[model samples]
Target: MPHQQTIERKTARTTTKFTGEVTCKGGSSRGIVKDLSAAGICFQLYFDINATTGQEVSIKSDEFGHLTGVVQWYRGDKIGIRLNVSSNTSAQISSYYKYFR
Candidate 1:
Protein backbone atom coordinates (compact mmCIF):
# COMPACT_ATOMS: atom_id res chain seq x y z
CA MET A 1 0.00 0.00 0.00
CA PRO A 2 1.20 3.50 -0.77
CA HIS A 3 1.77 5.80 2.19
CA GLN A 4 -0.95 8.36 2.72
CA GLN A 5 -0.78 11.74 4.44
CA THR A 6 -3.69 13.73 5.80
CA ILE A 7 -3.56 17.47 5.37
CA GLU A 8 -5.46 19.83 7.69
CA ARG A 9 -7.29 22.44 5.66
CA LYS A 10 -8.67 24.52 8.52
CA THR A 11 -7.05 26.52 11.32
CA ALA A 12 -8.17 24.80 14.50
CA ARG A 13 -8.29 26.65 17.78
CA THR A 14 -6.65 25.21 20.89
CA THR A 15 -8.42 22.03 22.01
CA THR A 16 -10.80 22.24 24.95
CA LYS A 17 -12.81 19.49 26.67
CA PHE A 18 -16.19 21.19 26.73
CA THR A 19 -19.39 19.23 27.27
CA GLY A 20 -22.28 19.65 24.83
CA GLU A 21 -25.04 17.90 22.92
CA VAL A 22 -25.72 17.22 19.23
CA THR A 23 -29.12 16.66 17.66
CA CYS A 24 -30.12 15.28 14.33
CA LYS A 25 -33.44 14.47 12.68
CA GLY A 26 -33.48 11.04 14.33
CA GLY A 27 -32.31 11.83 17.87
CA SER A 28 -29.74 13.48 20.09
CA SER A 29 -26.40 12.46 21.57
CA ARG A 30 -24.35 13.90 24.42
CA GLY A 31 -20.70 14.55 23.80
CA ILE A 32 -17.65 16.59 24.69
CA VAL A 33 -16.34 19.32 22.43
CA LYS A 34 -12.76 18.30 21.78
CA ASP A 35 -11.63 20.86 19.20
CA LEU A 36 -13.27 23.99 17.80
CA SER A 37 -12.57 26.44 14.99
CA ALA A 38 -14.23 29.01 12.79
CA ALA A 39 -15.03 26.45 10.13
CA GLY A 40 -15.70 23.30 12.12
CA ILE A 41 -15.71 21.41 15.40
CA CYS A 42 -14.72 17.94 16.71
CA PHE A 43 -16.52 16.08 19.44
CA GLN A 44 -16.82 12.59 20.94
CA LEU A 45 -20.20 11.13 21.82
CA TYR A 46 -20.66 9.34 25.12
CA PHE A 47 -22.57 6.65 23.25
CA ASP A 48 -22.49 5.74 19.64
CA ILE A 49 -25.49 6.67 17.51
CA ASN A 50 -26.53 6.20 13.89
CA ALA A 51 -24.66 9.23 12.58
CA THR A 52 -22.95 9.48 9.24
CA THR A 53 -21.08 11.90 7.06
CA GLY A 54 -23.00 14.53 5.05
CA GLN A 55 -25.70 14.49 7.70
CA GLU A 56 -26.96 17.82 9.03
CA VAL A 57 -26.80 18.41 12.77
CA SER A 58 -27.41 21.01 15.44
CA ILE A 59 -25.16 21.52 18.43
CA LYS A 60 -26.13 23.42 21.56
CA SER A 61 -24.96 24.10 25.10
CA ASP A 62 -25.10 26.57 27.94
CA GLU A 63 -22.04 28.45 26.69
CA PHE A 64 -23.25 28.75 23.12
CA GLY A 65 -26.61 28.73 21.41
CA HIS A 66 -27.75 26.30 18.72
CA LEU A 67 -25.14 25.89 15.97
CA THR A 68 -25.97 24.40 12.60
CA GLY A 69 -23.45 22.17 10.86
CA VAL A 70 -22.94 19.09 8.76
CA VAL A 71 -21.04 15.97 9.72
CA GLN A 72 -17.74 15.90 7.85
CA TRP A 73 -16.21 12.75 9.33
CA TYR A 74 -16.67 10.13 12.02
CA ARG A 75 -14.65 7.39 13.68
CA GLY A 76 -16.13 5.13 16.31
CA ASP A 77 -18.08 7.61 18.46
CA LYS A 78 -16.08 10.71 17.61
CA ILE A 79 -17.25 13.08 14.92
CA GLY A 80 -16.04 16.16 13.03
CA ILE A 81 -18.51 18.75 11.81
CA ARG A 82 -18.34 21.74 9.48
CA LEU A 83 -20.47 24.68 10.54
CA ASN A 84 -22.88 26.39 8.16
CA VAL A 85 -22.84 29.75 9.94
CA SER A 86 -20.32 32.52 9.49
CA SER A 87 -16.96 32.91 11.27
CA ASN A 88 -18.72 34.48 14.22
CA THR A 89 -19.19 30.99 15.63
CA SER A 90 -15.45 30.74 16.20
CA ALA A 91 -15.27 34.09 17.96
CA GLN A 92 -18.12 33.11 20.25
CA ILE A 93 -16.44 29.84 21.17
CA SER A 94 -13.12 31.58 21.72
CA SER A 95 -14.72 34.13 23.98
CA TYR A 96 -16.44 31.39 25.92
CA TYR A 97 -13.09 29.70 26.53
CA LYS A 98 -11.36 32.88 27.66
CA TYR A 99 -14.05 33.85 30.16
CA PHE A 100 -15.15 30.40 31.34
CA ARG A 101 -11.79 28.66 31.50
Candidate 2:
Protein backbone atom coordinates (compact mmCIF):
# COMPACT_ATOMS: atom_id res chain seq x y z
CA MET A 1 0.00 0.00 0.00
CA PRO A 2 1.14 3.51 -0.72
CA HIS A 3 1.68 5.92 2.15
CA GLN A 4 -1.13 8.41 2.66
CA GLN A 5 -0.46 11.99 3.68
CA THR A 6 -2.79 14.16 5.67
CA ILE A 7 -3.55 17.67 4.55
CA GLU A 8 -4.74 20.41 6.85
CA ARG A 9 -6.26 23.84 6.26
CA LYS A 10 -5.56 26.04 9.24
CA THR A 11 -7.59 28.99 8.01
CA ALA A 12 -8.93 30.09 4.65
CA ARG A 13 -9.21 33.78 3.86
CA THR A 14 -10.59 35.86 1.05
CA THR A 15 -9.95 39.43 0.01
CA THR A 16 -13.15 41.43 -0.18
CA LYS A 17 -14.47 44.98 -0.31
CA PHE A 18 -17.25 45.73 2.10
CA THR A 19 -18.20 48.48 4.47
CA GLY A 20 -18.89 47.51 8.05
CA GLU A 21 -19.81 49.34 11.18
CA VAL A 22 -17.56 48.41 14.08
CA THR A 23 -18.68 48.92 17.63
CA CYS A 24 -16.39 48.66 20.61
CA LYS A 25 -16.47 49.97 24.17
CA GLY A 26 -14.54 53.07 23.26
CA GLY A 27 -16.63 54.07 20.25
CA SER A 28 -18.00 53.10 16.85
CA SER A 29 -16.61 53.71 13.42
CA ARG A 30 -17.19 52.92 9.80
CA GLY A 31 -14.59 50.44 8.67
CA ILE A 32 -13.76 48.79 5.42
CA VAL A 33 -12.95 45.10 5.67
CA LYS A 34 -9.83 44.31 3.72
CA ASP A 35 -10.23 40.58 4.08
CA LEU A 36 -12.10 37.89 5.95
CA SER A 37 -11.28 34.34 7.00
CA ALA A 38 -12.69 31.55 9.03
CA ALA A 39 -10.26 32.41 11.79
CA GLY A 40 -10.05 36.17 11.59
CA ILE A 41 -10.81 39.46 9.88
CA CYS A 42 -8.81 42.58 8.91
CA PHE A 43 -10.13 46.08 8.45
CA GLN A 44 -9.13 49.71 8.26
CA LEU A 45 -11.10 52.28 10.21
CA TYR A 46 -12.07 55.65 8.84
CA PHE A 47 -12.64 57.15 12.29
CA ASP A 48 -10.82 56.51 15.55
CA ILE A 49 -12.72 53.81 17.38
CA ASN A 50 -9.89 53.43 19.92
CA ALA A 51 -9.85 49.64 19.85
CA THR A 52 -7.05 47.69 21.44
CA THR A 53 -5.78 44.13 21.53
CA GLY A 54 -8.11 41.61 23.19
CA GLN A 55 -11.02 44.02 23.01
CA GLU A 56 -14.32 42.42 22.04
CA VAL A 57 -16.20 44.11 19.24
CA SER A 58 -19.03 43.52 16.79
CA ILE A 59 -19.13 44.42 13.13
CA LYS A 60 -22.21 44.75 10.96
CA SER A 61 -21.80 44.29 7.26
CA ASP A 62 -24.25 43.86 4.43
CA GLU A 63 -22.67 40.71 3.07
CA PHE A 64 -21.93 38.87 6.29
CA GLY A 65 -24.32 40.53 8.67
CA HIS A 66 -22.98 40.82 12.20
CA LEU A 67 -19.80 39.20 13.43
CA THR A 68 -18.16 39.35 16.85
CA GLY A 69 -14.47 39.07 17.47
CA VAL A 70 -11.54 40.08 19.64
CA VAL A 71 -8.83 42.41 18.42
CA GLN A 72 -5.60 40.48 17.80
CA TRP A 73 -3.25 43.11 16.38
CA TYR A 74 -3.04 46.48 14.71
CA ARG A 75 -1.00 48.70 12.45
CA GLY A 76 -1.99 52.35 12.36
CA ASP A 77 -5.74 52.44 11.69
CA LYS A 78 -5.86 48.90 10.35
CA ILE A 79 -6.74 46.10 12.72
CA GLY A 80 -6.73 42.31 12.78
CA ILE A 81 -9.33 40.46 14.77
CA ARG A 82 -9.73 36.85 15.76
CA LEU A 83 -13.31 35.80 15.31
CA ASN A 84 -15.46 34.10 17.91
CA VAL A 85 -17.81 32.03 15.81
CA SER A 86 -20.08 29.05 15.97
CA SER A 87 -19.74 26.17 13.53
CA ASN A 88 -22.44 27.70 11.38
CA THR A 89 -20.62 30.98 11.21
CA SER A 90 -17.38 29.21 10.34
CA ALA A 91 -19.13 27.42 7.50
CA GLN A 92 -20.63 30.69 6.36
CA ILE A 93 -17.22 32.29 6.19
CA SER A 94 -15.91 29.38 4.16
CA SER A 95 -18.86 29.59 1.80
CA TYR A 96 -18.40 33.29 1.32
CA TYR A 97 -14.77 32.75 0.43
CA LYS A 98 -15.60 29.91 -1.91
CA TYR A 99 -18.51 31.43 -3.80
CA PHE A 100 -18.23 35.17 -3.46
CA ARG A 101 -14.52 36.09 -3.24
Best by TM-score: 1
Question: Measured by C-alpha RMSD in angstroms, how accurate is candidate 2?
Answer: 7.0
Residue range with the least summed lDDT across 10 consecutive positions in model 1: 8-17
For all predictions, the C-alpha RMSD in Å is: 2.1, 7.0
The digit string of per-residue lDDT tens for model 1 on 53-88 reads: 999999997776678899999899899988886766
TM-score of 2: 0.81
Task: Give the lowest summed-lDDT range of ten residues in model 2.
Answer: 92-101
Q: On residues 1-101, what C-alpha lDDT tens digit does candidate 2 reach at each position?
A: 99999866478677878898889999999989998888888999999888999999998887777889999987899999888969867776766667666
User: Residue 62 deviation, candidate 1, in Å?
Assistant: 1.8
Error of 2 at 19 (Å): 0.8
